[model samples]
Target: MRLIAGATAALSAALTAVLLVPQPASAATQLIGNGAFTSSTTPWAAIGQTTVTAESGWMKVAVKQVVANPWDAMVAAPTTAALNPGKSYTLSFDAYSTTAFKARATVQYTATPSANQLLATDVQLTTESKRYSIPFTAATATDTAAEVTFQLGGSGGAPTVRFDNVSLLETQTTRPTALYVSPLSNPARWAGDPANDGDTAKAIAADIANEPIFEWFGGWFGDITKAVDDYVGAAQAQDKLPMLVAYNIPNRDACGGQSGGGAGDATGYHNWITEFAKAIGTRHAIVVLEPDAVAAAECVTKFGKDPEDQYRMLLDATQVLRAQAPNAWVYLDAANATWHAPDKMAPLLVKSGIANTRGFSVNVSNYFTTVDSETYSVAVNGYLSGTVGTKKYVIDTSRNGNGPYEDDTPGDNWCNPPGRKLGTPPIRQLSGAEYLFWVKVPGDSDGQCGISDEPAGTFDPDLAMALING
Candidate 1:
């Protein structure tokens, strides 16, 4: 029941949803030699009155507009080392101003470096210290070194800026061994809210600790961009790459008797995808686009909307995502091993921008074995052997470890398959697979498997234990 004035309730709900999900922390890679200023600023270039002794553990600068230096007032430093291209990097540091100084920091790149990009802005910094972070994707093919320039002083007058605990790190995002559980498909608030209780946290603690989690998207209504923005922020906070499932195809998950709904119509989906793309922005992500959108088109192939039409939709969606979030990688859903023939699926994938995406995923919500999925994927890859680019696929190892339940028919028992074990947790470069991800949250009931009375996507303890324990 919708409350009459539910803004307060809505806000509370939004806050609660974000809180249950914990962020994952990542390791840092250093590039600056004397970033901390422990020793004299040898590797770091300083002009005018920039010295290490001015502050306890920082480089204090009191510089003016000088001869050919051309900077308003700042201290600049170039990396004594080179940087790897095609990787995005972030630099963070603590800054304090003796007075009200508008501070800005610029980072420079290329083998022969000069000032190019500005990171931090001219905010009025007071005596109190504040942390500032800046990230840049190295698109330059020949960037050999990196440099940072800081404007410590205000434009109004000569400024004094001090920096400490400086760190530069590559945005270390690899495929998940088990990415931090994300709140995609509106999972039980934390990872996948299959249990629908606060106590699920008490239960998930043991396995989830090191279980690199991934998130899903594409099920919400209204402004989903806000949710994506929130989820991405949370993932970044934990240093995990947020993986999303773009499931809101115009008509998705048809004969499977699952959540077979989209935003509204085909036009409706286009609008939704537009916002979805904008929300992701330039943050790094791994997206599994439109699960079952292409594979299940036979269920909705009526009137004018044929399988080819669905293919067009998926192709357009990938283009939108690529144009909007350049760093984010896309993976189309290739259905499961049992669903489609490799030849049928391969051509569809190539048509739906497979070359543009990282790859496709399989067995997203089924009890299929990883070995079988890999075998099927290899056959499909063979079909498009020379056509697809880089050509790899991810498997839904979320629930395939002990293997599938003995089904009467190969088509039967995808929902809440009994005795299925949690498969391999998300791992990077898992030989045949790109990443073995928890695409389907383990504990959530799959459309009310007869044994359990819980709603779809809610936690089921019996199912959870079978998968978790195995």
Candidate 2:
């Protein structure tokens, strides 16, 4: 059957159809704190006459005692909330120590008395305020009877510690829709150069059916415009998302006269960021802005000069990209676990302007345990939420199962350290972040460059297999 319609009528119908279509979901998130305790009506009991104050989405617990150990108390969820079998959830809270004291906190999750219990124990505390997340997965269970308790302990004299902003949420189970590969298309190297016969991009798409997050090199001090265009065009043709990594740090690679090149100045770098944003405008892409930029700032400060200014430029670049690519997801590179604290960095990110930035990425290069990374992420996100009023973060779980074993062998051996494996399955939502992605391809070389170079990104078939199965 055929129906004929006039051009005006058809156009009117098309306009109506467009209006009916649902727009893409925005990435706005909500903050959940201790004040929203709905599972029980009983208020948290103070320990040993400790004073408590509720402020900024947290119940600040404080204590004063000179001689003996002082501890503050908080009630766990009163009712038992059973976790679905084989499902995971993240539990997080904020804690801070006012003085130097050996502090340890215990969070007990009451589960069915079974052989395998999902409980987190003996978490350490620091002088600075921080948040911690403990992830639990439930095994087969018949009845629902589970409760979680959080306890803080201090050693020696009474040192006051505050606790606040506790929350529990079901983690998302979906996999990531994109991936980012770094140093893949840099201009200087054989593997990074586009002209190479065995570039990682084609290999990834062909082997894994996953597109590579292309990181193109910019000019001496500016954005790499043409490289982005080429990669984006090729990616679109293959119906894949293009991922980018910005590495044009001033005096790049420390300008220590290493193989890494050096940029001219901050002004040049800022201009390059602007150019990069312009080139990537209005495209749906995933970007890892400045790998190790935040964590590796010390090197730039020592050698490249003006590390603080460079970080400011990086933040500015993030803002520019957000405005330029409204539909794109912009992620800040947390680089690894050793980088600055999330709370400390979040304020700087906001001060430099993060209203448009999507979220931050953790464990970019180093091999921090997934549990440890999650804890770090939760703390960072908590600080961000408290200060900037947002809850969002991303984690990199490329090769972190066994974590880097402590070795006194020395000499940058951690780069391609052996015996490391993959972690648990990647969760989409954890501690308010959107997703945990295997951003670094497991099989790719970490630029060990050669055997003498101390194996960077060394390929591990065993780890790769584990990741695939997970």
Candidate 3:
């Protein structure tokens, strides 16, 4: 329902359906010396109102007084190597407090009053020891005399803290193999709804709810950061890769269709996407960014706005996700196989920051066969061969079993086409595609077109049953 035969307005006013990690890196170079504290505390020191000792292979600190700030009482050690700007690093350590409290782990210059700080993160401590791994980029210039310190103060009461196996290392980005299966998916929720009982719920659970699907997010979200944090936190708890669709862009659905709302303007879009990326933080994720965004730029010209402005917005969004959510694998949407030729779409994607992303996504929220999408994606990759290098792609295999609705007119072919069945189930590295995802929820209505009169994005069980039966 997102794009028609061409990147133009729909025949009818069809409403488009709306839809961490911080794990340690492997094969990294340790940048901190004497991290295990096995021998003695030579370079380490207890800063204020505390006693530090190395014994039993762990550094123990006994706090003598409560302080106003965490930095008031700290256990600090100088780094063995310099930290370079723009390089990714991870700080991992095992720690526990005699009493439950909070502390700060900071990376800064060794000077008494450092001018710049590279990383400072708040950490919660419990009676039981647990390992914490934090990933961050060096935001400042090279610091040869930097130090890693643990600030244990401002807890309203003194508490003893222990640390072990502390290590700081330079790391690499690794994509996750397993996709997260959220229990919060639309179909999964529908299956559990009291109204949907017996066979309906069972069918949904078996055919759709069990599959991992991408969740769509946009400007409608009130607390965008919390929403993103909750979703990513859930995925991290399960040690799975979460998939998301970022659909909100200013002047979205510029075709003057039902799915027309977005952030108020370009600045609003940048701020919104920035917060979204920050919430994902260091967690691993797959983002299908702004479906139809690149393709629909052509329509923005009719609104008396430069299409280049839209491209710039998308490119900024890509940069934000790249810098803020380092572990996330982003795929800029390239519409579909039928919308634009590879030559036409290639340059658009390039201008829209495809180079900053993992790759591009095709056939999002649309009905297109996986084979056709693979062909189109391969062609686009060919055009981008020298410019963007070897880029990967994903296909939306939600509902294209019967292909396009040939019986209907070209204008209405994309909206709720009857006889359409669920395509291949979502899988990673399937048929040369990086991933095949249910980008479009299978049972959701496209608009008041073809067989469905429901509003866009509303669930229709009867329609879902038809697709499943086929």
Candidate 2: Cα lDDT at 138: 58
Q: Give a tens-digit lDDT track for model 2, residues 1-470.
A: 00010111111221110112112222212113243433432355555535555545455555544434323432344323455667654455566676645543322324443344455455566676655545456566665455554444345444456665454444334322433323343211333345645544344333332323335345642225445654543343333456666667565545222225535677877777766665555545677676566655566655637667767877788778877655467787655554566667666556544556777777764567655666666766677786666646666665566664455543343344566565433444523346655666555455442122423334433333433333
Per-prediction backbone clash count: 19, 5, 0
Alpha carbon lDDT of residue 159, candidate 2? 48
Across 134-245, the per-residue lDDT of candidate 1 in tens digits comes to 5566655455566777755335555567777565556555532224445443333453444545565545544542454455456553447545655654565456677777
Q: Locate the minimum summed-lDDT window of 10 residues in model 2.
A: 1-10
Candidate 3 stretches greater than 4 Å from native: 6-175
Clashing pairs in 2: 223-272, 251-263, 446-456, 446-457, 448-456
**Higher TM-score: candidate 1 or 3?**
3
Q: How many angstroms is residue 321 displaced in model 2 relative to the true structure, after the best TM-score fit?
A: 0.8
Better of 2 and 3 by TM-score: 3
lDDT winner between 1 and 2, please give it.
1
- For candidate 3, the lDDT comes to 0.80
Give the winner by lDDT: 1 or 3: 3
Which numbered prediction scores highest in lDDT against the true structure? 3
